[model samples]
Target: MLIRKALIEDLNNIMNIIANAINDMESKGIYQWDNTYPNEKIFSNDIFKNNLYLYVDKNIIHGIIVLNEHQEDEYESLKWKYISGNHLIVHRLCVDPKYQGKGVAKDLMKFAEKYAKENNYESIRLDAFSQNERACKLYENFGYNKVGIVTFRKGDFYCFEKRLIKYGS
Candidate 1:
């Protein structure tokens, strides 16, 4: 498997993955990502700016992460600052439904961490819908601690953070 920067051509695949994710989450009572937000504009801008990260296996995009150099504009007033300088914010992270439970998401996250480290970032921060218990559990299991909660256009989501520094240092 290889992780690389996303390009304009990958937008459709990423859209399908995220669309399916939203539908699946709704089916499971998790109201995250509807017809709004994360639309073409967001994806287009990310691809244009080369801010999207992708994980590929056998030349297929399995997972995609829309990352930014700093906190998203919507999160500016929420006190969601990252203590670490040059922190990369994980805006949207979704794996193809077919690739779920295959550690693809975890691997993508690790790639993000590595990318941040190489660029001098000290940590990464992200948030997920409060109703998405599976994602919450996944983040927790991956060592992300709940920093707080914030409400977005869809609903409230738990904020999480993972420091890159050594434990208890």
Candidate 2:
């Protein structure tokens, strides 16, 4: 699979991937997303700002990730282990439900880490739905520190941050 910055034409494909993810989560009793969140407009905005990225293989988008520097107000109150104004905040990380167990999520995360370090960013920050055990486990196993919890429209989410270092350190 190849990971690269998303193009305008990739919007619809990305939305389909997200929809599949939402359905997969709800089917598993994880209410992490609903109709209102991660809508087309939000994704359009992300695409406009060139913050969106996609994992594509042979012309199909298998995963999506958004990286921005803005953190929510709720994050300001959390005690993060690493404090940095220079960081890449990850949002709306989703893999096509059909391709999930094939290490697509892992590839996306590794891409995020490399993106941060290559761009001279200090770290990667993100939040996961408290009920998304698979996502929480992925983040934890990947060495992201869960520093606090924050509430969003769906429900509570655990905030995480991973400080960047030289590759292979």
Candidate 3:
């Protein structure tokens, strides 16, 4: 599989992946996403900003991840460990339901980490739905530290941060 920046032509495939993910999540009792959030407009903006990426195999998109500096206003109140440097925030990470449990999300995360480090980012931040055990575990297992909680329309989410650069050496 190859991870690359998303192009305008990949929007439909990206949306299909997201729609499948949303349906699967809802079926499994995870209401973290819905029709209102993660709409096409938001993804269009992500693509336009050059922050969207796709995990593809043989030209078929399997997963997507959005990395940028934008964070919710609620993050301002959270006590983050890496407070004084450029940070990459992860958003809208999703995989097609057919590709779930196949390390697609993990691969996307690996890509995000590499991209952040290569781009001189000091840390990476994200918020996982409190009820999404799979996502929470993925972040925790990947060594992300739980910093705080942020409440959105769906519910409270656990804010996590992973520092990529140490102070010395």
Candidate 1 lDDT for residue 55 = 89
Worst 10 residues of 3 by lDDT: 160-169
Q: What TM-score quantifies how close candidate 3 is to the native fold?
A: 0.96
* TM-score of each prediction: 0.88, 0.95, 0.96
lDDT (Cα, tens digit) per residue for candidate 3, span 1-169: 8998899899988888888889899999999998899899999999999999999998899999999999999999999989878999999999899988999999999889988888888999999999999999999999999999999999999999999963244
Higher-ranked by lDDT: 2 or 3: 3
* Model 1 Cα lDDT, one tens digit per residue, 69-138: 6665555555544564666788788888889999998898787777767676677788988988888898
Full-model lDDT for every candidate = 0.80, 0.89, 0.92
Residue 107, candidate 1: how far off, in angstroms?
Answer: 0.4
The candidate scoring highest on TM-score is 3
Q: Candidate 2, 75: how far from true, in Å?
A: 0.1
State how far residue 95 of model 2 sits from its true place (Å): 0.4
User: Global lDDT for candidate 3?
Assistant: 0.92
